[model samples]
Target chain A: MGVVMAVPRHVACVMDGNGRWAALRSLPRTAGHEAAEAAVMDVIEAARSSGVTWLSLYAFSTENWRRPAVEVDVLMRLVRRAIRKHAPVLHARGVRCRFLGMSDPRIPAPLVRDVADLMTLTRDNRRMTLTVAFDHGGRRDIVEAARSLIRSALPADQVTEASFAEHLPYSDTPDVDLVIRTSGEQRISNFMLWQVAYAEWIFPQVLWPDFRATHFRECLDAYRRRRRRFGDVGRTATTTGEGPR
Target chain B: MSRTTPQESADVFGPDSILRRLVGQARWALPVVRATLLEAAHPQIGAALMEHSTFLTHPWRRLRNTATSARRILDPDPRVRDREVVRLNRLHARMSGTDAQGRPYDATDRDARAWVVATLFESTVTMCRLGGEVLDADAMRRLYDEHRTFLALIDGGSDRLPATLPEFWPYYDHVVEHRLENNEAVGVILYRLLADVPAPPALRARPELWVMGRSVAGPLATAIIVASLPESFSRRVALPDLPGARTLMRSTYLAAALATRYLPESLTRVETFMGLAGAGADPWASVRRQAGKAAALVRLLTPAAEDDGETVRSADRFFAEVLDQTGDGYLRWPDLAAMAREVATRLDLGEHDEERLFQAYAAWWRELQTALDGDGDGRVTRHEYAAAAASLPGSGLIKVADVLFDVTDADDDGAIDADEYHNLFRTAFQRDLADGGGTSYSRGAFVRQFVSFMSGQQHSSAYASLLSQA
Candidate 1:
């Protein structure tokens, strides 16, 4: 079937395999995270060129809690160092930086400084938005949304698939259209909850540090091949036919 | 020989200088050099009468060269002009104060650095919050630069924060549209990105299932999550278009930009909201400088609480439904996750409570679907209730009689009862404030006197005020 080049308005990626990527090169795992951070600048610029308004990257997950505390601490410090170093480029380009994750009480104290510091520094950027999903869990997001609604006193029958989305953690962002998980991982690993219900998923073999914008484009190309069906008939199904996949 | 002069050295450096020259050729650099000195105290600021033992002036070209080199490599953006100003103030503070990082001679200098941090955070946050209204990237970058520079004040003085946060106090304000680095815990970013997956719209009526989305959806869900707690009317106004205003758009956008370059401490919400704000600086320490980070509790004049601590729940479920519906729209706004985090801080809500509130929030959504899913011919649709079922909030809210509800003759043909309005009105006056904080009717010192006129009087009066403002 013929496909439409429907690039996602909002694109999200899981920057995975930093440790493995570093180890494979006979380097410290910390090097991998650093490399991945360095790589972010190029990809970000590329994304802007492509006109993607919102880019969400999976930097850390709630499940990552199982790792050794020291490694985590190192990563947190690296994040600060990278931000301190790369922030000028981001600011000049007009890119706004924030993240998706558990609120402060859930995240540790040492890292909170960098988080808070970064948030305050770049509050007025406009070129593009980059959201880092750190220490985030999908199920927790849904539950939180549900809880928010109950406190508001909404009635029983009024609840719908659409009603609940209003309360989720990312309620302020748009629905995701495509998601790319790096480091050869085939799994989605619990990311966006309500926002990416119908998002197309792609798993690339390259680790986050090595993944380039061209690779990102390839993923978008793959997403472009599918016929999205929002539990309804595809547009082609009803019409004379742009055909089907 | 390197254009180093003893006189200039005496002017800028502390008393411990090992070497000094008589004079040199590049002494013309004083204009720029003098500005830096002015920024710091004249070894003394406005009100101060005393002088420090270590105070001294030093060479300008070398420091200027260092600053230029640093900005060239680490800070190439002009948008962060406020950051430059803050850095200048901080250095100024350190020069005047005794306890700067390098100054061993003067450790007793009153902590002026704290004020610099505090002001920097407040000004930057306010600037970003307001600039986000237009969704201008340039403006956002500028504010973010200011945020980052203020962070140098004293990140290690973490102990200076409020010894302890207030118990049971709700948080609602926070920075937004930025990304924070998680260097310490390699994988750990910030608390802003906690959820495993994005929360999706749930099936109507069964709101309890929402709590389990992470576990329930698992690998099938995208592996990124973020949320916002509740924010107030003022935040919404910060953007444009709400009642169509964009001011209330998204915090993630604001947080993300700033996170990449924020007042480092403010983005993360350390021991206190942030350490640098210098909120409790000595009253005597004052500087004529630009406002830094501007953090303030959102002030709203809500309805007054009753004398009996009874809150009158509004019978306008329709308005509540609209609020819920509008909230759903929040999911699609630009940087909502950061906005959610901001709301959490603004509300001072715990993640657990935020989750519960969301559950309650989802449960309350039931009434909206029923209204929206009407027949094409305008026939009303009704959801059945057993009547004997318990009315606990967690279970589900019952759409009962509003004071102005129209009860139809269901006996003749299963219609609503007209007296439901009076029942709803009565119920409004007799609501139970389940949360321990206080009765829904109890107004914390925050409520203004003028708004108190309509408390417990008429629901329409509150609506009238809102409408009048709109």
Candidate 2:
């Protein structure tokens, strides 16, 4: 009999090496971006089937804006097209779509509008949540939460970790339990810092465009084998019981 | 013989020392289990286990607790070792109960104590043998002597322990033949311990290997147990002596030891084991120190009560009420001195307990001189103290309010609200506050005191002054 695997409740993926993948193929960078769409879809399907409630895709980082203006513009356009093309499929699959990160003025107005509309349309989907982080930075998110707390006029003594967490955008999603960073990047890259304090990390060598359902499953299997101690001295979960509360 | 200094004693049990290497190796697991089973076979110990242990309900936790205690006993820190001695003493004091056959059992009984010591000696030898690290006659004698010294330190006396390794063998043989039994409780606990063995990572990665691993684990564990047992005891337990089981067990342990020698220290050394071992440069000590600092910060920020109604008492009322319990409503020097000594002892100041108590008394004396010694003659009569102490104002007891505000503010915005205070207190002091009562804080009282203290309008009352100075 196959051993039962403990799937993480939330999985965050840092899709990396698209540019490197394109360079290696002697193809335009846009091809790498285009190919990543299929990988994203495959992972989403895999995660949903594997009982992962939340999947976050690091599609665009706040630091990416500092790249060539043309690349940044093309990336923004590609993001909008991906949202428009995938929204119907995501909705049909009972997947909720949400965008995380700063709502900066630099992002084109039409793309922002489409993101909001797609989120609102799939707001009720409960099977799984697919969060696409555009222009996101973990430090920025923390700073924004602090600003929100200050603006709320809540009493200082009453503010707590839970209360401050509520101020973060998309506060309904739980902490990321497993983070898969493709392209062999070991560092977190300042993504979901507060939410992934004890999350198991898998740094797969495959580029984002080459990642598939099988690779995603392999990452899940790897995560299942991790003994997440959370700064304590034992395995966080057993094979047959709920994990540590 | 000259008295051994703490450093010299620590050197004998250091991380790289043979004793630690033997005890910490993965090959010792089977032998440790064998020892545990043997110890439980004693009727008094079995009765104690039946009464006091929760091995049936929380087997893993019970096992981990036992391992932690063992680690503490072997810890390098004199303070930690002394604390474990006290803890074991208290535990031994409580281990008295009637057996299943209506015979009264006591772990402190002469026979039971001897059996316990024998189990220890037997386990050490068995572990060395199984690990393929055979000790010669002199080495065996030295190991036994060291253990005897340890037994004396923890158990208070070694009168019941055998005088030498040669003498111990007969006692061990007699116990294995006459005293050891296949008690149902012991069997069940042994089964649980074996069943919970974590699968090797290579096997865990493959479904077929995982199943195969599970299927073989039971017999392999049983064979290890059988191999470690003496011939007569194996016959008594109905475990037929397989022709090559002993050799197989030794070879398996030897291979494991070889693998461990080649693997990275980080992978080979169990982090929990290392942390509990209290060896050189404990990482958990830093974690614990940070936790303690965080707890102190939380306590500083959290108000004593959750509502304005009962949170704040008139300074005079609080002093009078608290002092009345100390003695007769008036604070006395002798009472303060006694309180200081008690606090020092409770805090485990170790050999410096008297020094700490003296410091506490001196600090309180200084505070008293500043607040109530109006004559400046270094002594204040009761009339002089009572007259001067009435006007003393009460401030928040702990002084880290500003630092706590900065830490909890989250945004570094200068002004902190009730939410920041509540969250910081909960996160930093969850364990302490859980034991204190609940996490709720009196926002009104906290804010009032904090604001007054910050603005320099609040002063330390006599009671607050004494505690703060201490």
Candidate 3:
């Protein structure tokens, strides 16, 4: 059967199971982190090539600070190195780079400078936007947004869902159409608090380090196969409005 | 069985009417789920639900709301019934949306509205049949006519509905075969029904009992739902073939038949309609009082006489179904050990958690043996085990509840929030039935209500009211 495939406008990836992947290989967790840089670059390249307008990656949660200091240190170092390596290639490809939650002061000043420089360097590159959520919490984002709104002295009655959404960071990012969480875990882990109201989630069993462009394309195909209702009646035919009963 | 006269049939709420009798059955819940599924199978209705309804998220609340709406429409007072119908019509009138294919759907569409009512008539009939109430052709015709009358009362249009039972069959079959789509909504509803039925909170507190009930009733409910669907539709939907499904369906039919035939209406019928059906005496209270008197007499006759309580009978059944995994008609050490392992596995516990569960179960078993092993045979008979059930909850058995509760309290905040509680059941039994989403309260209070329900401290009606609100 011939079928038309629809491409998702915004796709997010919850890069999970790195620890498990590393443990499985009997390597230090840093090895898994190092391996994941290839998957990240592959997904970004594949998504842009596939006509996706926006892509977000969940790199670290706000709760990751609770992890042992050594693992956290390794992750911080790995992220800075990956950014330095990929910044020029990403800018050349016309991809806008963004860092979502670098509010914590523990992040090294030099690494922060490197990230800010990349963001400024790619500010005008609009072929696609890549949002990396580092030390991010979905609930905390909402709370911070609410604080911003309160600080603005906006009237309570005027705070519609749309208006409240405007106060959120990166408000231009459209609602996520597809979320791919690798390694088969189903929990949201607080990714994209305000934007994924009706996102279609695909949890593939492959670990983050092993997830490739083929798997990414497979997820896209799966997303096409799904019928997104968006809290309305499913459109089943070519028939338009028949008007009143 | 006595035949209903036309005069009695006209009054659908009359005690002897088929509508009254069928709606009164506690098994009415079966038809409600089936009817909801069938309605959602319609592409337009399913779309409207996605847009305007929370059926996907809060189905338990939706079911209770649907039941409430039905009860209001069937209220004994004409004014109340008319008012409810008007309110419903207004609510439905406001619902309009575009489908995925961009086909505009007005919820007030006559055919769609009529189909909704038709599903109720058809599903209730199927429910009655599956529940062992014989609905022959004549009875079906009578019921159909009454339903038509009901439709006219609610929608003020019976013209869109089939006029006769024979006509209804063709119309129903055509819709089932041609119009119904195995859409996303239908798939979700069916999947949740079959795979996600959670044990009630009381059962959750008792892991072994939860498994026992889950193993049987979960599959049985799913079987009845799949069996009730026409074979062509079932095949078209590509529902998985359940092993022993035929046997389960037949067993359900036979059990329902016997219950309807032998059990008093008070036991067989739903509690909501008891007073409206003009019940004379409170049968539950009367039974309780008589049981109390009998227990007193037994105590006077013999100082060593045991309670022989309802709890004990329940325990007796639990002993057989859950604790006695070997099915040797005795409770042995191996049985307790197996139960501990089963509970741990069902809960998806790690080795450390499993060991804790094992220790608790072993302690409880030793307590049972010390108190109830009359013959010193290193085994407890059903009677001896049951005799100690009255006191079992206070013994080491409570540790099991504690373990289950602790496992459920995900954050270890000493209180299981709604999500944690729901997650526990979804983790253990694939899904949960207690629509804890709508209610905001600690799990402790919910468990207490369930306990009161099981021990019969709270009246069935009271428990039902609490559950419906929950």
Pick by TM-score: which candidate is best?
A: 2
Better of 1 and 3 by lDDT: 3
In terms of lDDT, model 2 sits at 0.61
Per residue, candidate 1 scores C-alpha lDDT tens digits across A80-195 of 56665666567668788786664534354434545544554555677778888877888877766666666555898999877777666545677776788887787768888667
Residue B292 of model 3, lDDT score: 34
Q: How far out, in Å, is residue B5 in model 1?
A: 74
Clashing pairs in 3: A231-B50, A231-B51, A233-B47, A234-B100, A235-B99, A235-B100, A235-B101, B196-B431
What TM-score would you give candidate 2 relative to the actual structure? 0.43
The alpha-carbon lDDT assigned to residue B152 of candidate 2 equals 65
For residue B344, model 3's alpha carbon misses the true position, in angstroms, by 43
Q: Pick the candidate with the highest lDDT.
A: 3
Residue-level lDDT of model 3, residues A135-245, one tens digit each, is 888887787678667755689999999988876777788888789999999988989877877777889999999999999999998776554331135454222223121
Tens digit of per-residue lDDT, candidate 3, span B1-470: 11222222234454455775666566677777778788888887877664555344334434544665676666666665666676566556646868777879777777777788789898877767666667888888777776776677766758878777767789989998998888767876777544554433222223444467767766677777777777878888887667787667667666766776788866777663332221223444443334433332232223222223744455554554445544457877655654453344234455456667767777878877888899999898988866655554444666655665676565777766556644443221111112211223245544554444332333223233222211
For all predictions in the order shown, the interface RMSD in Å is 13.1, 22.7, 32.7
Please provide TM-scores, in order, for all candidate models, with all chains considered together: 0.36, 0.43, 0.38
